[model samples]
Target: MPRRAMLRSAAVAGTAATLSLVPATASAAPNRWTPEELKDRKRVLEAGFTEAEADCWLLVVRATAAFFALPELHPLAKPEVVTAVHVIQDKLMMRPAYRKYRAANP
Candidate 1:
């Protein structure tokens, strides 16, 4: 599969898996998101997304992080894989619904 396609598949699969699990609340200390994740959560909430949407977006973010950590993506010195990974990550930063929220808020 193409790199982008593989990444998309990973995200979709991850989202499905996450949806089946209980979601973590922002106030949950043990389940607290990373600092960067907290920032993203705040941004999405302020952008008018519902709690559920923010949760899903965070899951997508996590899914991409896992994808990047895969063994296949090793050897960061490879020019082609590095460029592809960058492009994929940039696109994944905002899902379509998240974009709509930001656009509406802006």
Candidate 2:
């Protein structure tokens, strides 16, 4: 598999993992989204994002969730960490072979 495909797979896995932790009814329903739900929403948005856009939005979700899940990472003030990761993921998604190779590898 190519490096780009690997990166996209990692991002998708990360996003899926994060989504799994939240209850399905949270954001999909009427109430205001919990912080966790917001984070998940952000992750979904980031997952669909491209590198040219504000890719940091997705990173914010992942980093925030990571910080919440593992306080040891201490991602308190690091708002842009998730964005950086999303940018990397987006770059990988742009590669023509990424999706094809990802399907084959997975």
Candidate 3:
């Protein structure tokens, strides 16, 4: 499976399994990424993305990255790509704003 699909599926499975453990009033929201972090993600997606789809694509990237475990370094991609993607995803997942947003939105 594509990384994004795998992440999304895992998130769905996790949420379903944990639903009973959460308070009824709790909310789920989308994670936010920093401008710099977004820029890097944008650049990666752009390499294979069309201009019209950039915003939505970046959103998916941020969302998927936020939920999934960071991928380990791959031999094919540059070291920076792996490192940057991991950092961006980690930050998105851990940010206070993201947690709050998820609580409010989801």
Q: Per-model C-alpha lDDT, please?
A: 0.60, 0.50, 0.48
Clashing pairs in 2: 56-83, 59-82, 59-83
Question: Least lDDT summed over 10 consecutive residues: which range in candidate 3?
Answer: 22-31
Model 2: ten consecutive residues of lowest lDDT: 49-58
lDDT of 3 by residue, 3-52 (tens): 75565555545543553343332232113456775676567454544332
On TM-score, the leading prediction is 1
- lDDT, candidate 3, at 71: 63
TM-score between model 1 and native: 0.47
Give candidate 3 misplaced runs (Cα > 4 Å).
1-33, 41-48, 69-106
| Cα shift from native, residue 44, model 1 (Å) | 0.5
lDDT of 2 by residue, 9-37 (tens): 66657755764554453333324446775
Q: What is the TM-score of each candidate against the true structure?
A: 0.47, 0.29, 0.25
- What ordering of candidates by TM-score runs from best to worst? 1, 2, 3
lDDT of 1 by residue, 1-106 (tens): 9976676566545545665574654335325678888788788788666666676567656755676676664453244444544454445445656778888999
Query: Model 1 — which ten-residue stretch has the worst lDDT?
Result: 76-85
lDDT at position 22, candidate 3: 36
Report how far residue 11 has shifted in candidate 3, in Å: 9.3
